[model samples]
Target: MIKEKTFTLKDNYVCTSQHKLYALFSFLSARDAYTFLCNWFEKFPEHKESTFYIAGESYAGKYVPELAEVVYDNNNKKNGSSLHINLKGILLGNPETSDAEDWRGWVDYAWSHAVISDETHRIITRTCNFSSDNTWSNDECNEAVAEVLKQYHEIDIYSIYTSVCIGDSARSSYFDSALFKTNSRISSKRMPPRLMGGYDPCLDDYARVFYNRADVQKSLHASDGVNLKNWSICNMEIFNNWTGSKPSVLPIYEKLIAGGLRIWVYSGDTDGRVPVLATRYSLSALELPIKTAWRPWYHEKQVSGWLQEYEGLTFATFRGAGHAVPCFKPSSSLAFFSAFLSGVPPPPSR
Candidate 1:
């Protein structure tokens, strides 16, 4: 889906930003997909009352809440013909809801992990306004950011503690076409066959191969105008073509939370891409009162990770998991999801 070209009254010309481009996709695809499901339920009355939950991870952090807010708004409208979607809650994992806070926390996280020195961190904290939409003209801030990049040059920035696939080149550049390339091949490099939790870091490579197979695509009815071999796991063209992003999702959260929608945000502790620190910093801006004190939640006899309940939100972390918690700690993630759907916290012992 594409954002239709529109005129800007201020400049008296057609204009758009990356955010506007992606927003069009969300409205055409994501929101319409929700409507289709709701209509399906309407046709099949037996499941009409079933609750729907919006869930996504990473960049979806922005999408999930926006979609939920849309659903919530639709439910409230008195439009006689509209479907009242029962959007019960939303689940976000390592979400990038606030670009400013997330990027600011990235530098702080790098410093805390010793990827950069304290002095550099101090300089960056004072000099940079990562929240700004414009490019920085300040040389000192640019130099500081460059140094931080250099420090993390060799590391697996996604999961800082994990082993990087050997053949994968260290990603030194900003988000670009390379982002799409890595999703299909990163796991295929010379990483260990398996981690302790039976997580295969190279699974993306296997998926890439499987999805591109003509037979497999045929079976799944996954034909597209793009050739199967050339269809990337992630559409780089869409990502690269994005014109801009909304400044913050905090206001959306505020609106949804006030509207009484259940909200839970979880993070895998080791994720460097949208680290736990970033999540914490972003959420802190909301300043919600604590409904429950922070404590370690458990799965079976062992501690899974920490959790905290606020007036309108629940925050949790998977102890040793990375960006994708289920990929690393499936059992614990299942437990978390079960509790979330049930409108309860994970039991202290189970």
Candidate 2:
């Protein structure tokens, strides 16, 4: 009779932080509220429902994969005696798969999209490798970041051109060179339009990690409870805790594709983070028999993006989008989803 909320995913990621877990629980609780709506339709077995899709951008990209895997795996575990839950498909946006090559790929992408400048990209590129988990000077990093966007006047990581630049210190003491969504325009005022509201959610999200204060400390006290290091210590081990748990999207993609699940992996042409090359490696790793090699697709009746369709996966590029897809190009994005939802995989757009 009714349907789940159109879009309900919140900031749940694949990590193991207690505070983060608490926040994620809140997020899931909200999502469950939405999921429960669909259970109503579970009855009336003959009633056809609209397509159920899992979609999100940026971290959503990373999050949706695990979510879909859970659904698919759960569906498989049903013995002969149980009613199966129907899941339609997934739409992974600018995902941050923590692959070494994938991470480094963002630097080049940010530059190409004019998210950062050539010089700034060069500085950060030469200074630090993307895969390693290390802390460097905020000032220096910001300086290199600034140089990259020297020509753009104001650079925005969210502006479809530089989606891979989502990683950052949410509460930066001083402004850095990398023009984020917040810093696109110069504001002499200490509290700019975006930085208002006394505090920012994104700032607090990172602050809890960097300093360990949760739920907003009314009085910034010296008590051990107020100190943020304890949270940091635990947060430090998050990546280490599940050190080798980077699941390959390729194998999973292959299985689904073989099962006739229409699959597509479209990258932002400018995203060096999770660059086209890494995607190629992953797709080829699926061992799908080659059907069509690389080709191009048209947008606005002009050559737009490169593509490849093999036995299992269909790979394409968003001409100007970064890691995130639909956020950058909504029409093409909508078209992509519409195609997937209809099981109408488009011909290869190389």
Residue-by-residue lDDT tens digits, candidate 2, 226-281: 44334321231233233222333444454455555555667766544355655554
lDDT tens readout by residue for model 1, 1-350: 11112221110111122112112334444455555555576568677577989899987887787667666755775642245667889999998877667878777888888888998898878877765434255556666766765555456666678775544311212332344222232211011111111135444456666787887776776764245654344554455455334446787788788888899999988877678998999899889999999999999879999999999999999988887789889898998999999999997654
Which candidate has the highest TM-score of all?
1
In model 1, which range of ten residues has the least summed lDDT? 188-197
lDDT to native, each model: 0.67, 0.46
Q: How well does candidate 2 score on lDDT at residue 262?
A: 54
Tell me the spans in candidate 1 whose CA falls farther than 4 Å from its real position.
Answer: 1-30, 150-153, 169-199, 220-228, 235-237
Measured against the true structure, the TM-scores of the candidates, in listed sequence, are: 0.78, 0.52
Clashes of each: 6, 21
RMSD for all candidates, in order, please. 8.4, 12.7
Model 1 TM-score is 0.78
Best by lDDT: 1
